[model samples]
Target: MTEGSKLLSEMNERSREVFRRVVEGYLSSGEPVGSRTLTRSMSEKVSAATIRNVMQDLEYLGLLDSPHVSAGRVPTQLGLRMFVDGLMEVATVGPDDRAALDATLGSNERDVGTLLDRVGSALSGLTQGASLVLAPKREAPIRHIEFVSLAPDRALVVLVFADGHVENRVFRPPLGQTPSSMREAANFLNAVAEGKTLSDLRGHIAREIAAHRQELDGLAQDLVESGLALWQDAGESYERLIVRGRSNLIGAAEAAELARVRTLFDDLERKRDIVDFLELAEGGDGVRIFIGSENKLFSLSGSSLVVSPYMNADRKIIGAIGVIGPTRLNYGRIVPIVDYTAQLVGRLLSER
Candidate 1:
């Protein structure tokens, strides 16, 4: 038998029950659990002998540890993983939970940052663990374009997006950029690029420029080329990432647990790593759950992520929404919560 299964099959019903209850108790109280603790309590059905033998098996499986202070078994990281993965029965979210998530989606016309803040706060409250909501670095679609020459060496480049957004950037020509070349580049973009994506727009402009190298004199060509390069570089900039729930770290009982949360915050603040986390949410399509140490991204912290990616009208993936909490989390109930939140996000974003 494989390792996980071998460990599980060796576990009888009584063993499973003892382990789950003990783990749950330890999680709740942050204390080591003793067999006498079980005998005197509600789970009194099993003999102390039965509980002891089972607890020993759990220790052998590397799921539980006998700490020196309490002479009682405490859940190891691996133990928590097993309980979260297969033993714990999660309750689905109820109507009240749905209402809580719905409240975060009420404002449809507000900007993205406000929406993200609300999501983070909502998740923190729901999970009682810290939450992080990463926002898209920028949101703009092409609307219209205009080029105006203010002087022989300077020109104003204007861009309009379909979202009724307008941005104006000024660029100085290399030496003498004739107004005609500026107009040509602007006219080409406005006419040919209406429904294209932002990345698509950049590529199209580059291709057009490259396909015809001899279309303008040195000064005019230099002005047009530099302007394109500058905008593309700006667009490549990252999206803002927001992490909420630093307070959760302070409550972790063990120093080891505290270090993990610190490392997680460090990674969440990194643009590239945060982007990877976002991508994981996007790939899952619906709610995705990561158990304790199941992923190195969150391994150090013994945390879990319940995430869902919300979509736009075209069914395009826009962003992810999720909650981060300790691994002892109730996944069965939280799964429904995360799923409902993603639905609300999609509905809110799509509303006219």
Candidate 2:
């Protein structure tokens, strides 16, 4: 076992009980836990003096801290991490919650964006914290591509994926391009780009156009290149991180916690870091927890994230779903909930 686990193992039963009660009490009510408060709750009738001695030992071991000179003690971030990893009893998703998730997320919705929105809302409501989902970076192969002319120099590009999902982008054809050239370009793309992903099509179309440049006029060539490039750009745009229920973070905040909440809000606005953080979960199997000061992204905010990566049919990790809340969050309950939701999202995507 690691040093932390060994330290926990060496704790006497009474000491462990006192420490657990202190952490649980602090988590339940965001306040420091006093020895007298813990004495009344213990089953073995431990004295307040004895509890205070145990708390002092816990503080010396770096598991607890006193915010003020005479105030009660609170669990530090290290203490909370050790409790979550070693001591906490995770709660299973209740039958009612399981049914609610099933009804809400297990619907027949096939649109990925719409499904993510619903998932975020359901998770926020269940956990009473902010929810975030990183959308899949890989896209389905194209089944069809069409171009419709709105004017001599403008058109609409419609992409139909193999999963029956359709996306449209407004296309600005090269100057002096005509309607007939757009139709011809669309027909060529429809024939060659089918059954290929954007990455594959980019390389294949580039080669095909270079070899057959003599067979087409300038406008048609420009339109074909523009259309393919546009589709590739659109695919990149779909790689997004969706956040919901940020207001819930504010609602649960105490006066002193507002500055940290504001910092978290600023961090959310920087999508690059959030995306990078979620991507770290892609290689892991189960739920991953990042406590305050453990990850620099939320260190200043004293926040915690419980994230789990979702997978596709081939067991490839595609995306992640998670909850962001204060360090005092109910981990025993939320860990199982996030794990179950991640599994459900993976299964749904594989089925789709």
Candidate 3:
């Protein structure tokens, strides 16, 4: 069993009941739950004093804490983690939500960006938290390729894929590159692009260039290599990160919480950092949760992240989708939503 389970095993039934009630109350209201509150809701009608002693014991075990000396106890980060891992009962996604997700994502839309935006919007709205989506790199076969010279030194490479995706990228042409060389490059690409993805075409070109079998001149060869290299270096810039409903994070923040929300806003502004952080989910099999200081990016804000990796047709992890919200957010409810959404996205991507 996990450490959380072990800790739970050490607690007596009465202690467990009180702890569960405290965590549940805290999660629902984002406030400390007192002994009287637990006594009123507990099944066995335990006295308030007995519950208070149990809370003090739980607090000593590093599972609960009080915001003020006179106030009741709220679950600490450790307490929340323990509750989530051991005591909390996760709810299944309802039929309405499941149908909603299917209707939104199962549309005939082939555009990856539109699908991803819809996913972000849906998750954020449902969870009432900020949604983050890491879009996977596309590898559809190339349909057509063109090089349109923009300036003497710069040119635009327009690439169309078989999946109806078009990408335009700008590259600096080699010195002495002319219309003739650009045409030659386009012709070469069109010749070999049939049923081949950009990466595959790049490999074929590299092999041909190494064998010195191409008919293109030096300028055109350089242009082809530079254009391919540009896409490689761009590192999935074609709609990689989609963040939605950031304003939803600011709802119902107390004056004391404003600074933390500001800190979270600052964290969100660092898109690169968030992307890097999401990459950690790529290594895991299913849903993972990070609370409070568990994830460094949101440590200062004391936020929680519930993320799950979506996979490709080959069962390989491709990207991730998740939510960012306060530590007191509804873990039981939101967790299954994230898990189901990740599976749905994987299936949709596979079908495409």
Candidate 4:
């Protein structure tokens, strides 16, 4: 047997029962569990002294810890991990939740931002914790491009993608450019840049202008370069992580828990690190669990994440959906909820 399995197997029946009861109690109430409490709940007739001895043994095994000198003991991060991976019983998503998820996410909404917002809100309402959605990073190919003059020196660039998604960005036209010239530039791009990504179109337009500089007027050439440069620089704002229900973190009134929740808010503000952590789930097949300090990103907050990757029609991993809650959160209930939401997200993307 593996080392962890061997450790579990070596525990005697009474010790296992005592350890299970302690973890369960801690998870249910977020409080330290005492030996007397375990004695009362346990089916077998066990004395408080015997339970205390068992707890001491488990603590020595690095599975439990006493938060205070006199207070009852609580499960350590290791203990929680062991309980989740081996001892905990996971529950499936119920029919009502499934129907709610379907109703919320079943829309044919083509706007990616709107879809993700709805997803985050739905997950937050269901889980009663903060929800996160990592948007897809892949850019769709350009099917059409149009430029409309907004002012003497400003214009709106409308890009229509092959997937029927449209995006608009403001562009500053070069000096001495007219509306007719802007239209010409847009037409030229639409004719030649179709099916090419923004990056590819930038390079293609640069080379075309270099070779055929005399074919267009000076203002037209400058306008083309300006539009392409504007798009290339806009890449930073594209894919982003969406977060919702941060207030749920502050639901607990305990001073220590409130402090931890404040730290978690600070962690969420560091979007880049959270995105990198969520990206780890992209390589996995199904739900990925990061319990408490197991992930350095959330170690300070003492929070846990249950994330699952969603894919596109081509089965390419596109993004992730998950919930972030305290270590004492309901793991058994949330696991299947996350898993099912991920599958639903993938199916929705495929249909689109």
- The prediction achieving the highest lDDT against the true structure is 3
TM-score, cand. 4: 0.76
TM-score for predicted model 1 compared with the true structure: 0.75
Preferred candidate (TM-score higher): 3 or 4: 3
TM-score, every prediction: 0.75, 0.77, 0.79, 0.76
lDDT (Cα, tens digit) per residue for candidate 4, span 191-305:
7789987757767888888887887777777888887766553634554678898988788436777888888887777674745665668657798888887767777788888
Clashing pairs in 2: none
What local lDDT score does residue 278 receive in model 1, on the 0 to 100 scale? 74
Residue-level lDDT of model 1, residues 1-352, one tens digit each, is: 4455566667877778788878888867777898878877644476777778778888888989997755489888777767766776767778787777777767654776777777778877777777766565344667777777878767777777777766667777566556676676666667656766465666787786676667645554566667775455343333456667668655753676777777777777664466567787877558887766666467676777888877878897777777777766666677777787777767677673
Q: How would you encode candidate 3's per-residue C-alpha lDDT over 1-352 as one tens digit per residue?
A: 8667788999999899889989999889988899878878998978888888898999999899989977499998888999998888989998887887777787788788899999999999889999989887778888888999999988888888898878888878887889998998888778877788765766787776666545678888888777768546263555677889888878856778779988888766656574565566865678889999987777888789999999889998878998998888898989999999999999899887
The TM-score ranking, best first, is: 3, 2, 4, 1
The RMSD of every model to the true structure, in order and in angstroms, is 4.9, 5.0, 4.0, 5.4
| Angstrom error at residue 307, model 2 | 0.6
Give the winner by TM-score: 3
Kindly indicate the candidate among 1 and 4 with the higher lDDT: 4
Off by over 4 Å in 4: 1-3, 143-239
Ten contiguous residues minimizing lDDT sum, candidate 1:
230-239
- Which structure is stronger by TM-score: 1 or 3? 3
lDDT scores for all predictions?
0.71, 0.83, 0.83, 0.82
lDDT tens per residue, model 2, 203-282? 89988889888977778889898876674435354536788889989988989999999998888876657556666576
Assess the local accuracy of residue 241 in candidate 2 as a C-alpha lDDT between 0 and 100: 77
Model 3 spans with C-alpha error above 4 angstroms: 1-3, 142-166, 170-238, 274-278
Error of 2 at 49 (Å): 1.2
